[model samples]
Target: MRYLPLTETDRSAMLDAIGAPDVDALFSDVPPGLYLDGPIEGLPHHATEMAVEKHMRRLSKRNLAAADAPFFLGAGAYKHHVPATVDHIIQRGEFLTAYTPYQPEIAQGTLQMLFEFQTQVARLYGCAVANASMYDGSTACWEAVAMASRVTRRKRVVLSGALHPHYAEVVRTMAKFTEDEIAGASPSLTATPDDDGLIARIDENTASVVVQYPDILGRIPDLRKIAEAAHAKGAKLIVVNTEPVALGALEAPGNLGADIVVGEGQGIGVGLQFGGPYLGLFAITDPKLVRQMPGRLCGETVDADGKRGFVLTLSTREQHIRREKATSNICTNSGLCALAFSVHMTLLGEAGLRALAAENHRLACIASDRLAKLPGVEVLNTHFFNEFTLMLPTDTRQLVRDLADKGILGGVSLGKLFPQEDALSGGLLVTVTETTTEEDIETLASALEEALS
Candidate 1:
């Protein structure tokens, strides 16, 4: 049964109050092509339960699950083996049902867990402190830009060409309302990242310079050099890391002189759950700049009985304060995803993480070597962690579709990421993780050879 309860008079009153003539007029901002004008052609809304279930089951089979193919897709989200224990621990009733601790004092267990998560993120990022979490990496990147503006009292943000395009877009989209000036450019096809060019763009008015470590094309950028150049002009250096596992192999952004580090925690505890419900990790190397940071910061305190306690330290986002004073408009953090990350990090520890990183690099080297030997494929990275770029001879968009048709999940194509840029149409990003077997690489190599030929 349909559940819309609004009477015609009630809806008309609401529309008139908003100065909109009808319900359709309320959605006038939406493009006409996007929304449906009438009921769907064939499917009945009130079909029998059995019929609906049967139809849904048939539709579900069309999806190619990651484990079922020679999967290599990773521009931001990755496919790694999550330990069974991570799922077991997070699914427990105590943790599973928990969301944000609004009445935080009584939610000791949740607070303690968040405090631990913060500690793990801080150490991982080599930052002085970290917030509980944010919506995801893109939003966290925007928050860093906002924080840098507050610290430097400047409106200009210098974005590196190698920064993730999606992250860069998120910053630009949010900047439209905030009046922040975004200076962005497309990534070059050079083997190494253009650190000097990025530094040259920084000026006195620049609030922050954002760079992604092991950047979009999977080439490692010189963070220390960029950090120094930005700091010389009294601008903050915001580092974005999409693959947290790379930090286990590469240097932490904070340790390399970044003022703030933001990244996706999905590489850790969270698996690629069809694009969403991923975690965001935010941290700052300079403790003095903590107040300007977004989201919630959980801290330890002594209770009335002198016992250890956990509490929300700074939640200056829109919910707790006047809108004008809020450091961010973000209202909630990814609490469950944060817990999953903490548990995975704890299980890995420092040594285990390093070992895991080494294996990923080993496998990636093997895959890259195999792929580079192909007749028309050119490796674009002089140095990388586990992921790298390849300049292919063919239009990778069509090639990717062909590979998928052959029951193989190929890497992300540049055409998909930069649909408008004709020059970048053939670049393909290949990501290798510990879960990717040698056979999978062989399968991809053979497929590429046959397809390219």
Candidate 2:
């Protein structure tokens, strides 16, 4: 049965109330050439539900599934092993049905989860405080820049060459509307860290110097110099961590003097479901800047009976406060994803996380070492956590496709991300997680060798 709530009379009344001649008149402003006169060009008019489902399944089969092959693709989104227990916990009725904790009295369970999430993130980043969570790492990075601008009263944001191009683009798009000056350098594809140029760009007018930890190319450069340089000029050092698992092995950004630490938290308890609902981890080192932090913050408190409880501590979004006075326009936190992360972190604990991080690094090192021995291939990073870039003999874009044809989901092609940069035209970003097996690494190495040969 067709489900049209509005009848001709209702439509006519609405049109008449708006002083429009007819239904077609409503779209008079749209150009005739651009308007669709009928059903979309390629779609069928109708089909049985089962037939439609089968057709969708056939279409889905054409695309590659990361898990079906020896997967190494990681340029922001990663493939990590999420425990089955994490899913079991998040699917509980109380967790799955819960929404934002607007009222603390009735929403104590969710509030407590968020409070625990915040604590986990703060400890993971080694910061004083962390918000509940943001949209994702990219938007969270942009928010950090905006917060820096607010704190320093400056408009210039300096981006490191090693920062992910996609993430840098997000900051650029957000800065475009606010008239913030963005100084971004071309991607660094060399063996040694090339951050001197980025540091030189920071001056008195700069609001923030944003650098990726174990950057897009997967090199872990010493950030102390960059942090000091930004601090000397009254600018904040904002660190981006696309892969949160690296935190398990590397020194926390806050301990390294970063003012704001933001990154993707999809590595823990979150599967890479086609780049969707990933977690965003945001933290601040100083207490004075807490008010400027965006999104909702869950806090711990005591009730009148002296019983410990949880509540929504700060909600500076436009929905809760005046538009002009709000710290950010983001309405809510990534509650479910944050819960997954909290649960995963709780299960892993400190020792387990460190071991997992160590395994990732070990596998990455083995893969890099074996791949570098191949003809005309060079590992670009002297130090990396679990992911790194490789300079290939031929164009990386074609090589990636060739690898895919050979049933191996090889690493991301840098040329696809930054086509304009000739230096990165032959670059490939490969990642190795705890999930990567010895056989998988060997398969990639052999396939890569055959492809280049």
TM-score of each: 0.88, 0.88
Candidate 1, superposed: residue stretches over 4 Å from native: 1-57, 316-318
TM-score of structure candidate 1: 0.88
Clashing residue pairs for model 1:
none
Cα lDDT listed for each candidate: 0.91, 0.89
Using lDDT as the measure, which candidate wins? 1
Q: What is the lDDT of residue 35 in candidate 1?
A: 75
Q: Tell me how many clashing residue pairs each candidate has.
A: 0, 0
Number of residue pairs clashing in candidate 1, backbone atoms closer than 3 angstroms, sequence gap of 3 or more or interchain = 0
Query: What is the per-residue lDDT of model 1 for residues 1-453, given as tens digits with 9 covering 90 to 100?
Result: 335698888888888889987677767788999978778999756777688799999988889889999988888898888999999988898778866776766788889999999999999999999999998999999999999998999999999988889999999999999999999988999999999999999999999999999899999988999988999999999999999999899999999999999999999999998878999899999898787788888888898899999888766545567576888888789988999999999999999899999999999999999999999999999998888998998889999999999999889998889887888888999999999999999999999999989
